[model samples]
Target: MAAENRAFVGSIVVAGAILVAGSPFLMGFLQKWESGKARVLVVYADPLAGGLPTVCNGLTRHVTSTPIIVGERWTDEQCDAEERSAVVAVQKRLAPCFKRPPSQMVFDMATSHAWNLGPAATCGSGAMTAWNRGQWTLGCQRIARGDDGTLVWSYTCKTVGGQRQCTFVQGLANRRADEAQTCGEVL
Candidate 1:
């Protein structure tokens, strides 16, 4: 099983290393959002927003064959392998949603959005609708902001005046903006 896992990672590394028409590698670009820790798990939760247990590369689940535990440790290689595997799985799950083939940049951005949000949300998003129509710029813009110009998928629920309301998070907004820039990059 160890040998098989290593072999699988080897293949992913090869595929990940190949440049797609000067586009950034998905894993490397994704690192800007999902940082890696070599020797420990990075677990965090938003006080108001609520979050899940996350490991290397923002992974919440399927980090390993065994279920992940809080405060568990992992090697750099382990983290890298699992991260690549997760990225591949996300890509595959999101593949059928696009009616037209996307450029590498667009595809990577879409995958990044889905990585933060779930695949179900991404599939039903207006961005997905625009992409399905081959409207790349519109889709990219929509990834960060809605038609009303408010940030999307960057909100976390917070209690305001004793009522829970969704509020924008600067960090998540920043990530969305960066993704939008990358997706909007002119080839």
Candidate 2:
């Protein structure tokens, strides 16, 4: 009986080891999740919408347009250059805070998230801690909630009495989801 019990225990241990080794494959990544694909991530967060002044993070300014006067427009080249410059500034602010320096795409996404969400949300919140602790996906998800916690991407709005009343912004939520996904991806 003792011999048989020993064999059974050995078999269980072997099976457990195999399961652990194969866990990553089951989870869809070859290893633990950690992504920083800034370049690709930026594409998802910031799409080209023409050379017009836009409001982001409650600041009405044009990254692509200099002076950002009302009704001012910019060339695609100017916009692209300015956007890149803005990303650089964001990267500089966030890079040092990350426990692991993210890949370019991840960095870009985070920068875009900050740009879209707000500066207070980027480094001065749980997202920063998440990035430092490798729980960045969760951090990014939290970022979607905003500083006041008034929004949730998971919830949408309906037309109430023909008035568009909403507690959530679908686009913003999607952006946050993309950021979180990008952050959790394996580089």
Candidate 3:
């Protein structure tokens, strides 16, 4: 595999030292926004629409070693390990989608999106398309919204009143807006 593809698969040895994929800022961003600290370290039903049994910095079976059981608890060490594992897994899967090295801002924004949505959704998004085309600002705009001003990923299928429907979430909107603002810093 190419050097970039090897990134996030695991720490790479360079100059006799190991380094992760992105800057420390990326990990801090995830740790802060995903979860501040493992208060309980127990799996709980996430409040987001279509949310899964998430624990420890938004970990799910999709990116975990095993299925998450509701009410089950994990140690701080385990939670921390899984958090790193999940982020690296996401970066490994999504790395191939970038035809070129994206700006740090775009990379962070897209990785955050892929962390929430699957890499498949992110790879197929207009933001990814723009990034691959070397349109950083457009990619950031698409991350905030779609091709239009409508929010790109601020809704999810939520069952309410015995009916499943797409529900708009202000938290998600705010998160995307924050991502856009961060992306704008690079412009």
The lDDT values for all models are 0.68, 0.43, 0.72
Question: Which model is ahead, 1 or 3, in terms of TM-score?
Answer: 3
Q: Worst 10-residue stretch by lDDT in candidate 3? A: 1-10
Top candidate when judged by TM-score against the true structure? 3
* Candidate 3 clashing pairs, residues 3+ apart or interchain: none
TM-score per candidate: 0.77, 0.51, 0.80
RMSD of each: 5.9, 17.4, 6.3
How should the candidates be ordered by TM-score, best one leading?
A: 3, 1, 2
Across 1-187, the per-residue lDDT of candidate 3 in tens digits comes to 1233223435532223344554455656665666764334888888772557888767888888777988999876776566667777787787778876776667767778888888998899888898789788888888779775888788878668999888788878887887777876877
Off by over 4 Å in 1: 1-24, 36-51, 62-65, 158-164
Task: Tell me the lDDT of model 3 at 19.
Answer: 40
lDDT of 1 by residue, 63-140 (tens): 335465566666666666676667777766776787777777787788888888877788899899998887889999
lDDT of 2: 0.43
Residue 55, candidate 1: alpha-carbon lDDT: 67
TM-score: model 1 vs. ground truth:
0.77
Off by over 4 Å in 3: 1-22, 37-40, 49-51, 158-164
